[model samples]
Target chain A: MLAAGLLALSAGSSAATDGYAAIDGGTFRSVLPAGPGIEQVDVAPFRLAKTPVTNAQFLAFVQKHPQWRRDRVAGLFADQSYLQSWANPVVPGAGAPADAPVVQVSWFAASAYCESVEARLPTWYEWEYAAAADETRTDARSDPAFRARMLSWYARTADTPAAVGKGPVNAYGVFDLHALVWEWVSDFNALMVSTDSRDQGEDPDLLKFCGAGAITMQDKENYAVLMRIAMLSSLQGAYTTANLGFRCARDGDEP
Target chain B: MRSIRRLLRAMAASCLAVTFSVTAQDLPDDSVYQLQVPLRTQADTASTLDRWRGHPVLVSMFYASCGYVCPLLIRSTQKLDRDLDAAVRRNLRVILVSFDPDHDTPEVLAALSAKHGIDDTRWMLARAEAGDVRKLAAVLGIQYRKLPDGGFNHATIISLLGPDGRVLATTSNPSHPEAEFVAALRATAVASKTPAAP
Candidate 1:
């Protein structure tokens, strides 16, 4: 109860209500290959939000930056379905609660919201790194229990709306990393994988790509994380969906 | 003398205002020009996508150092240019923006332009800020990812834009201009020639 009271007090003062948790960066093996025969990549230290941005916080953002409001935002920056769940341009009353994680937000809108609070969206690597943790262990993808929990959450439909911070905190003190809503990363467009991307040299059209080749998955066994990458790769930046929301990340370890 | 200079400045500002209002009048709400990307062209001049707004344009993204498909990308557009009649060709502009802006500096872009015999009058090779590059690619529906080898894996797509920045059509097969893409180009050319309703 005391912790809850303290959290509310913090929420009233700044954007960091649940607060930001510091994650020590190090070399981590990712499901996606960095290069041929390279499965591990280095990550730098960063602070991440404890929970996803909620409807109430986003409503405040839209009110302050009217240009981001659904009616006023440029079509080039956001699509037709942006903020579709909202009852009005500014209110989240139609089934969306103030405490619920904001959904139906485009990448641009999400980035803008992060900017308003002096932070930015987490990159694909940062998100992947933080999400690999469970409550007790920093990297828990190896544990059967963790994988089972993730699979169960993945099975749940978004029909039952999600309220932010309802899930258990992970080892890094982050909440709702999974089993809630998929997120928007700052480098969302960088995951340019095609259906046959695994066959890199098949396309004769040399002008198509200027680099090594299309990215192929490294750890095929990690289906849960791979699914996230696949969904993110398929979306355009202007697209918004009912089950997509985001959180912010900042450089360094200052709370 | 100072008063006269101030008066000249005022006159120049008014003329600029008039030009902006005229260009802004007909732009569509969803036009890609709504994005304010700071671009640097091959000639090292600062510009934006809308600089070519008054003409029909063939737009694509590429890097100067791209080994394979990028050359074909140029050839495909050149083929389209070759197929067009002289009049339509003159009215059309071709823009190839670089996805690897860090490596594709103005000097490199200029050298590539010179080697390809790209007429600066009709074609522009350009690069933009990294953030702007992402936003531009987003608006154009192009996808790209930088590889660890300092190369990029990207989608090969060429888009056709009307006079006011509306995307008329796009195709992954730039080497072979589809009949529909050609027809859209023709329509855009005709529209460009016609005066505004006002």
Candidate 2:
């Protein structure tokens, strides 16, 4: 009976590893409002990879699922530049170091990799909630110093992304949420919409967006987070950028 | 009873075999139908994005409870249908998949189809799982976000797909359907009627 129970536990917790850290979630006040009259989003507890997915990890994924290889992937799922940094279809050499976060990846490719590991891309709210922390405090967005540090990273351009886990861990014990690469969220397309038609009053663009008003920015001063939202919203599923990468998340209580 | 169960099992196995063969043989690598998403139509029938594979199709995403613009989307499609020649119309299909699958059940989709007065023979209203809905929207380049009021904010886009499921053209202006899009639809429909060129 004990052996059978152990087998079931191992099956249920496939991605259980030291690399994944538990994030205790709660009401998070994101820069973008959840919707009309909804200022705070209720995020559920989940596990997030301690660092961004590395080139080596993604190399393993493509080796297993040849359809997702840089050459074999369909044009409908990824653009031509997808995995352009890799040395070859199966090799992540030189420019794409094994320890470096995988860049030039489309949302579809990133999601497929996460699914291969029995995980999924974190939702926008979950990412924001986890990213809102510093080394000391969980909700450190109010701190000018924290905001300044994050802004500095955005302003600095680098030819290649630094290795993951090079920065300090956050209050949630997760690293490189900000200072690494711009990550992909599952609902990247759902981030922004034009302002409500009712507010504009007989605007010609009303027909463009249907139903309730679009999401309005709550914290206008939070430019770092706002820029991330802008970049993500502008991307399509098949688009791949030079610095775009992703990490995986799992649902249910962290074990 | 034993014979009936065995017969049902055999039928199910044959259906699975047919599905696998279609997916493996005919689908193009870049076709939106490459997405293996299952959908349910207004008639409570299981369907897929490739149901009208051999014919030109007009596809869009909308929520059944959408108050204002969704109805306009339906009218725009109907106008496009009316603009086409009867012969071309007979060869074209219209599919509107719901972004809000939780509330837009098969029954709700059927009601919306009736309310719009669409010809069920050529027009299909369908709903897919939430994850599949997102994937379909991404492939169609449609954007949608759910509001706190349970209503969705979404783009109004109708895409024209060739007989092979590759996107041919798209129009976002529901108020005024583009003549170019109509012409493209007619061209694709007429082309589909002809035998393949060597």
List model 1 lDDT by residue over A110-184, tens digit each. 877877777878888899999999988989998878888898888888786777887788888899999899999
Misplaced by over 4 Å in model 1 are A1-19, A194-203, A206-208, A253-255, B1-26, B194-198
Taken over the whole model, the C-alpha lDDT of each candidate is: 0.79, 0.81
lDDT (Cα, tens digit) per residue for candidate 2, span A40-158:
88898898888899898899877666667776666778899999998898998899988789999998888888877778889999999999999999899999999999999899898
Off by over 4 Å in 2: A1-18, A194-206, B1-29, B194-198
Q: lDDT: which candidate is best?
A: 2
Ten consecutive residues with minimal summed lDDT in candidate 2 chain B? B16-25
TM-score of chain B for predicted candidate 1? 0.84
* Per-model TM-score versus the true fold: 0.87, 0.88
Q: Best candidate per DockQ, number?
A: 2
Residues B127-159 of candidate 1: C-alpha lDDT, one tens digit per residue: 987767777787788888877777777888788
Cα displacement (Å) at residue A213, model 2:
3.2
lDDT of 2 by residue, B70-112 (tens): 8878887798788777667878899999989899999999888
lDDT of 2 at B186: 70
